[model samples]
Target: MKMFMLKSLCLAAIMLIAVLTGMQLASSGIQKMKGYEDPNLETAVSFHEKDNNVKASILGNDISSHNIAAKKKKLEEISAFNFFSSMGKKLSNGITSASEKLIQFIAD
Candidate 1:
């Protein structure tokens, strides 16, 4: 019984160490993005159903590119018209609201 418990504890510790190491490595590498990512399938499908294209494109563009060249390339590649139209209109109207919220949130 003592040996079994020791083995289990050792295995658990090893697994925990591995998991933490992986998390640290991943965290230090490319900073995982935050905020809305529209072109993502989850975002696309959700907004696509509602026909909101602007939000999808802008968000998708933002998600896909961190720089000007990348942005243009991503924009060209992201040709999902259904999702684009659906998100675009919403994005256009919501930009002010979203920006305000962002500003307020950041300030907070």
Candidate 2:
């Protein structure tokens, strides 16, 4: 019973890792194909121009305006890696180092 439980737990962990990896790969591929850009970095402008006169109100007001503007915003490129995978790596490395240290301490 104990061995069966251990095997089941290990299988679940492996399946979870596989699913996360597949999702990360699919997300990265779609982003690359679509040329995805960060919308949060985008910029916009809103302006209001008005000319008011008392005489114009009684008579008629004629206003002509010409404006030309251009703006460019820099955007950050999306990383192809996911947080879970990166964190998993860091966690595994930490665990490995900790175990090695424990072994060295025990030996000495």
Which predicted model would earn the best TM-score? 2
lDDT: which candidate is best? 1
Write one digit per residue (lDDT tens) for candidate 1, span 2-97. Answer: 999999999999998687567555543434454333343222111232454332232234322246687678889996578878889899879989
- Root-mean-square deviation of every model: 22.8, 24.0
Question: How does each model score on TM-score?
Answer: 0.28, 0.34
Error at 107, model 2, angstroms? 43
Q: Work out how many backbone clashes candidate 1 has.
A: 12
